[model samples]
Target: MTIHFSCTQCGKCCHNLRLPLSLDEAADWIRRGGDIELFCEAIPWPVEPPQSDAQAAHKRRLSFAAMCGAVPIRVIVTVVAAFDGACPHLLHDGRCGAYGQRPRVCRIYPAEVNPFIHLTPASKACPPDAWTTDKPVFFANGQTLDSETSELISQSRAVAAQDAQLKERLCAYLDVHHMALANEGFAIHKRAPDVMLAALERLKHDRKQVAHGAAATWRFVSNRLSTVDTLVSIGADTAEVSSLPNALVSYIAFFPSDV
Candidate 1:
């Protein structure tokens, strides 16, 4: 069945949501002078039941925490930032501050795209009156997306999948284990942008180095490094560890583990 939607510019969708971002997008946001931590969050990979013995073995081999059911079956990190009650980019007049530069997910809004669903109206989040079955159907842009919606949805799905794959590759390269999401209501520090930026750069450099086998000996050495040392090398301030909130500390502590 065909769906119809038109954004009222009420700004409801911009509030109280987790905005997931790709690595490049996060970097771009930082470059744009945006407060990365205030609007972004890092989510660890989710735990899922093993689909096969092989998959279960892979998970177990990745970390002892997984074997003990403390870690997720997959080992990738996702970046998401909280919007609290309203997006910081939402202007006072109900307009987006970064309208032109908004993420692809925002551009495709009211239309859902994920691993299980694609090109469907997000009925629950959308206002009732925003959708209609009569007359011509319109999208957020006030244009008919009937023919283009499918392609847009496909592209969005592809991008999301690509981001996940990249994260997985990075995790494999770095031999990461036991990554975990922070508690939903955890407080983020003002210095989150600095910490995340440093982490991102370290991941990028380490991934490249590992790819070329820069130091076969170093890989073995890195495996022996403690979580604190790993965090410090990745630009996390060990000195500030004592001052960080409990949630952040717990999340960081899950980074290093052995199967």
Candidate 2:
């Protein structure tokens, strides 16, 4: 089976969403003088609510204590564009300003990178006209779809593995249990820039120390997660809506599934 694709560069894909970044890509963006807080957000792993009525009732009972207590907790770190609007790196002409240094997700666009799934035109983001049941189906870069998809799946796995390792260390450092789920949801647009800036610093410091003293450096990562926990706790306790951190607002809103 062969599928063809060509990015028209219409920029339809660049607007109205966050672009995910790997840890390395994010650090490089920060180092390039990008305002990490203004442009980036850390999205925690998402949790799915119970589907059955009885399970929902049980969940409600568990949530009677506090709203934040009901949040499905996880240790994954995924950075994304901070705004609900277009990406800041996107140029007015529908081209990426940081094209050379774009994130892996962007690089693998319109391709299904999940190893468990087979790539088909129906499963990709490309327009109907972008594909054909023809010979010599070429990706945007001229590589055959088979070749590109294989490479992308391999790359995605490596990146996912790195993220998982980081999540493990972060969870251990914070004394939190790890739960795996397909992370989803948009990061809050407005947040305390200082909070994220401090976290970025600690992340960089910890990454450097990982080669020599991983366990010792994990304390810094633990402190960052502790801050997020404290903020969420405060937001859950307060009735004053304005007092909640933007991230907490999004996190709590995701529960019960219907909202």
Best of the candidates, TM-score: 1
lDDT of 2 by residue, 1-259 (tens): 5456667677766666555665566556666544332211122213445556664433332121111233433333445554456777889998999898877777777665544345566655556666654434664342335576558656765775565445334323333221112122222322344444444556556754553222211110111233444435633211222233334223312222321
Clashes of 2: 0
- Cα lDDT of candidate 1 equals 0.48
When superposed on Cα atoms, how far off is each prediction in RMSD?
10.2, 10.4
Q: Which candidate is the best by lDDT?
A: 1
Per-residue lDDT of model 1, residues 28-145, tens digit only: 6665565543221222234544667664543333222212132123322445555578777889998999898877667767666553343445544667666776524644343336
- Model 1 has how many clashing residue pairs? 5
Model 2: worst 10 consecutive residues (lDDT sum): 214-223
TM of each candidate vs. truth: 0.55, 0.54
Q: Each candidate: how many clashes?
A: 5, 0
Return the TM-score for candidate 2, rounded to 2 decimals: 0.54
Quantify how close model 2 is to the true structure by its C-alpha RMSD in Å. Answer: 10.4
